[model samples]
Target: MIIDGHSYCFPPLGEANGFPTVQEHLRYLQREMADHHQPVWRLRDWAVGDNSLLAEPQDKTLQGLKEVNFRSGGYGRFVWTVEGEEYAKQYLPPYLTDLSHPPEMLIAQMDYIGIDRAVLHAHPIFGFLNDYLADCVQRYPNRLFALASIPEWKIEHDSQGIVNEIQRAYSKGLNGLQFSVHNRYRYSVTESWDAPACRPFWDGVTALGKPIFFTICAPCPGSTVEDYLSQLRIWQGWLTRYPNVSAVLTHGFPWRLFLSDHGLHLPDALFEPFRTSSAKLQLLFQISLGNVWDYPYTQLHPTIVQLVETLGSDRLMWGTDMPNVERFCNYRQNLETFRTHCQGVISDQDINNIIGGTAAQLFNLGDSQ
Candidate 1:
């Protein structure tokens, strides 16, 4: 079975609250936070309509920005606002005004890509998107699996709230918990899940025996590499203490770090300890188009080869990051490009693990029928 180990799906168009589009979400944040970063994300970029990549050749704004994984302007972490015309840009080739993909659309796309099943990360919305995801899973249980998202405030401020949300979603049959809390300035280290206020929530996650997934990446400005690295340590601390749980490093190619301002792609030495930690660390490689990371020298494929050799094949998985990168290349291209990269460096058996076999086992999707 060809299983896409990592991907995402948005709730259908009209199902959105205020924060559905990137621009609206940023506008909401700007209104809420009386902070320095607000202007950087709000006034100058989103409001002014000055987007470098959006103006580029792709014709699809969100998809192109996402295709490059929003490498600049704090857009990678969804910190920057992408408004009106920008929202028209799609990761898919067609110029789309509505980014919504109901279950049928997602299923059709999956069918086209030859994906038997996929583990989906729900879109982070104004309210809990779990119910929408639950409905999708219920409607197509064999074809889709999902992880639920929690608001950053709830995860940081309300411990019981976090637990409640998780329990509710789990009871509804969501597969795991997902967070992309990349903004350290707003959700400082003290307010994170590892902190006392949220410890109960982290404890509950371990207790529930569900896998955890999060995306942590360095914000472009007003934050340093140390700030980002510190959070990674905090995340690892949780993995170390709760040795029984499983978690994935889901964003920014943190598997390797963009160390130094010169754009050097080197592996973070701090993550070296967790490579063999008891808590399983599976990496979902979600680049757009090819077996490449825009980084210097080693694209993600070579890095995956290193990771597979070091961490063992079971510890890594392939994912297209779907819909988001669809504008850059066809789904078949994403799968095949990695296959091309693995041709020389990775053994065919290990390649199987990185692509689908390992993820199916980790996500417990059972045998592909």
Candidate 2:
């Protein structure tokens, strides 16, 4: 069975999407960017090719901004206009603009791509979707496993409320929790997940016996390799504290940042967390580094081989940050990048383990299958 381990399904990015209004959402975006010390207001366009959604030549005006409007197009491109001059734009699958990504649409894409199952993820931009995710899994019990997301900003002020949501989500059939450390830095005062303020939240999730998908990253833009390593050290501490809790390092390590003039310079200390049996790492290359490389991703093959060698294939799992990746490559390429492209370097047995076996065992997906 094939599983696309990391994917997002969310409402449209407007009033009905999550925030009270489009302006409110934009304000939230601006605040988030400013907090991270990034340029405010202008959203960076990461989409490329014939379908690039960034602002064009005619959109140079930036003086009087009385009205700001975010309009979604039928062709999967959305534009943010400041009084008539388009300032920012982004791309989503046309289906997503129509009504966001429902489970049925994702399932149809999976069926077309020969994917047997998928693991659903949540994010702050998607709003409170624990209940929504639970309902999706309930509708397609055997096909999807969803992880719950709580507002990290609320963790400090409302610990019990956060714990209640975890218990509530698990009771409703959600599989685990997707906790992003970068987002915590962007939204809250505390930087570390193992901080005293975060202790209650950690204790609550640990009590549920659910896996924690830790989305670790640099504290801010232009961070160094040491900054990335420091975050991993905190994660290592968490693993030591909760030895029985299963932890998956979502997006794996930040690969592009670690590369230098010589080659990939991953310090041995980065692998220290995996010393515990409870840790697993998700392999998400094509989508994560799509802007830097093209389809088939030959540049990343060596990196993939090294991960399998260092961590052992049994501890690695394959993931496609799909829907979002549709702008980069199709779902099929994401899977084949692992299944077919890695044929010479990775043995078939190891490939099987990375593609599905590891996730199946970690999530106990075999019982449902």
Candidate 3:
């Protein structure tokens, strides 16, 4: 069966934002800006309101940037506003204004794209969505599976709370965990999960016996290949220690970070983590480098061949970032990039595993039917 290995579902703007509070959310976003060099800003000159890619580009007032607010432009857009003037904005799907990207919305997109099932991810920007996602999965048991989110920042301080939430979310039928390595910055000193303090969190995850979907990338823009390689080493160490824990590298490897005028320069050392039996990688190029490359992404075909040859076809799974990727290409196009475009570079047999066979086996979707 065809399955989207990655996607997101959340509530409406009012219900979604204001996790701990608007001020804290702003601080977290600021930390993200400082920690990572977001390349999407380069997509369009945010100055002078040039969000032409959006269906309805709104006015951008950058002069008086005072506070960030949600529910702007009728509740679908996240805007940087001060006294009612929007300075900058992040546009979500317009349909989200009704009540966020519910299961129905994603299922409709999946059906239109001819996807049989999908796995959902919980994003911090959308606040904690374990309960919401549990309901979504409950509503569409055969069609969806979701991961639980934890406040990584609190793990060092509130380890019990973090573990409790994991157990609770798991008992409620949430499938696995979505752990963002970058979110650890919310805590003053950033450390890898292998750190002593994070032991309990990992132990809890181990007890549940579910896979972890990881968002691992360079911590900042100025980070070198070694810096990225260091993160992979940490992952390799974790997999070595917890041999039973299945791990998935969300969005695949950071190909964009390694790409330059010299073209994609991925070092052989980078694929070491996937050498672990329990590790898998998600190929969602459409969301990560869609702005930098076009549909069919012929440029990535060679990389795909290399990954298959090096990591083995069974270690790779296909995923679409879903609704968020709409700005770059529609849902159908996202699937076709791997399914149809990379035909010769990737054998039809390997393509079958990359698209659906692997995901179904990894996520245990076979029994869901």
Per TM-score, the best of the predicted structures is: 3
Per-residue alpha-carbon lDDT of model 1 for 144-263, expressed as tens digits? 988988765465467677788788999988999877664332333435546777676677767888887766655433355676777777777777787777777664354333534333
Model 1 TM-score?
0.73
Q: Model 1: residues >4 Å from true position, as ranges? A: 12-15, 18-95, 125-127, 183-190, 219-224, 252-264, 268-270, 276-299
Candidate-wise lDDT, in order: 0.57, 0.73, 0.72
TM-score of each: 0.73, 0.85, 0.86
lDDT of 2 at 304: 75
261 in model 3: Cα distance from truth in Å? 3.6
How far off is residue 56 in model 1, in Å? 23
Model 3 — which ten-residue stretch has the worst lDDT? 55-64
lDDT value, residue 223 of candidate 1: 51
Top-down TM-score ranking: 3, 2, 1
Tell me the lDDT of model 3 at 151.
Answer: 80
Worst 10 residues of 2 by lDDT: 57-66
Worst 10 residues of 1 by lDDT: 31-40
lDDT of 3 by residue, 291-329 (tens): 788887788877888889988888888988777777577
